[model samples]
Target: MATQNEVIFRLARSSRSVPRARALAHAVLSSWGVSQGTLEAAELVLSELVTNALRVRVPSDRQVGVRIARSLEDGLLRLEVSDAGSGRPEVRVPEDDETGGRGLLLVEALAHRWGVEERTGGIGKTVWAELKAPDIVAEPVGREVAAVLVRPGQWVRVWGEWRAVRTVDTGPYAAGGLAVVLGLDDGSALRVNAAEPLTVWNGGSSSAREGGEDEPG
Candidate 1:
């Protein structure tokens, strides 16, 4: 009976949305304070799920949906991808000569538990994966309001896309409780609190800042 807070993003039906979904997942999950390993695995799982959803032969108007939520009852992080298509997606052993068909296999291995469910609208299915996400705090009062003052040269999620921070204008440290401004690569400035909410984009892959998340390229 716990209240659920989820970040839901609607992605256009295109192959490019795959990486966007992954980056969005990284933003949201990192904000939730998931471990580095869990964050990486979640990214991969989301990428595969989105890829498979796009592969489904759905109508042109059907867009893909991503939902990220935490099950407070069991303390598990849930990731879901919905597509308005038919039939179930199963993990089959690929032939030795095959070059593909291993997406779900990776999901099955990484997720603590995952399955497919009939969507509520009665048109398609939702593929979900749950992982043991420790250290994620309790649900916040506002579901969609996550913001943080970013540092220069770091990647941050703003307006549903990963943007690199060009510069940060902290105003003056003398003024307590003042909002911080972040100048992004898109030539947009965002003001936010220096609190725990907006996710700093780190893929946990390497030590290089530029090599972290692909910046605009």
Candidate 2:
């Protein structure tokens, strides 16, 4: 059964309506305080799904259905973009400097998890994505021992003992852990752990270069 937190939008399966669909998604996600990074990823996912729908399906007067649901169990957001098309979703590989065949791959990379579902009582499919809330932080060398890195517009998760530099001024983050900045030749390395999981949603300015995921937690 659907809960009160869920938001559903139905639109015509056309290129012009794509922006409206994204706006609805953003509005729904905003109530949850979803981070900006996550919002961008969500928008991309919606675009891919809608574009595929328009490309493969016949033009119809019926409105396409888009559903955004929040799972109360784990604070994971679920997105379902459904269409009235009769064909199944497929990703074609491109040769040379091709621009196609990479949409689903991008979705897989950005979304924590995703899948497809056949619509009931009609011919259609829903591409879905589940993103975990940004709550867990990666700390340096502490009991938490797990860390998440936000690199230039990317999110990487890892686990290990965090270490810091001797000269670098470690701010309040040192006590919590160091926010390691990557891609620098400052001859310094700092480590931090579990500093609010470095939310990529609303943080405007870049804090530091993202350290690579050393190991899985």
Candidate 3:
């Protein structure tokens, strides 16, 4: 059973529209309770696709199209950027000193999978990418939860949604405990106790366990 949600934005062929597209994607994904890491990847992927679309030489009246869709059950976030131009985007190796031409490279690095497709009844094409959702699970009792440390770049469940830790505070205010700040895709921040039972990925291994107490509220 796959649950689907989608949002579309039609943007003018302007560089300014790229950030707006990313902002809209951030808001929609936040509302869907997507993990912060996934949201960040999705937003970057969306920006690249939209930026590429805007760079294509299209008619002034032909607007760029951005569609962000999520399949909750499949744990996939799909992003599509459509344009009215004729040529498809290709990845080219960029020189180190060059200031441009790395958009698709960034997309390839961030997205789980990405490709191009021709738009139906349109003169241009749609470039799409899919990002895998963050791994979040319950903590195992006794041994596993005792050894883990909450660190930046780790994902933790907060308020029933998984969020990436942006910063960790271990000052006197924490009373020997730790405080963590989470970052949303839209640049918003959330603060939570590091002692809370939040799931953390164990390196690149195949398991995730609780890093703190038992089941956060």
Q: What TM-score, over all chains together, does every model reach?
A: 0.64, 0.56, 0.60
Query: TM-score for model 1?
Result: 0.64
Q: What is the lDDT of candidate 2?
A: 0.53
Better of 1 and 2 by TM-score: 1
- TM-score (C-alpha, index-matched) for candidate 3: 0.60
- Highest TM-score: give the candidate number: 1
Better of 2 and 3 by lDDT: 3
List the global CA lDDT of all models: 0.72, 0.53, 0.63
Position 186, candidate 2: lDDT: 24
> What is the alpha-carbon lDDT of model 3 when measured against the actual structure?
0.63
Who wins the lDDT comparison? Answer: 1
On a 0 to 1 TM-score scale, where does candidate 2 land against the true structure?
0.56
Model 3 lDDT per residue over 28-61, tens place: 6765777788888888889889888878887876
User: After superposition on all CA atoms, what RMSD does each candidate show versus the true structure?
Assistant: 7.7, 17.0, 13.9
Tens digits of lDDT, candidate 1, 1-217: 2232566656667766777777667766766777899889998998999999989998866878788888665768899999999899999999999999999999999999999999996689999999888767764422332344455766665675445677777653344665678887556787766553665554332222233222331
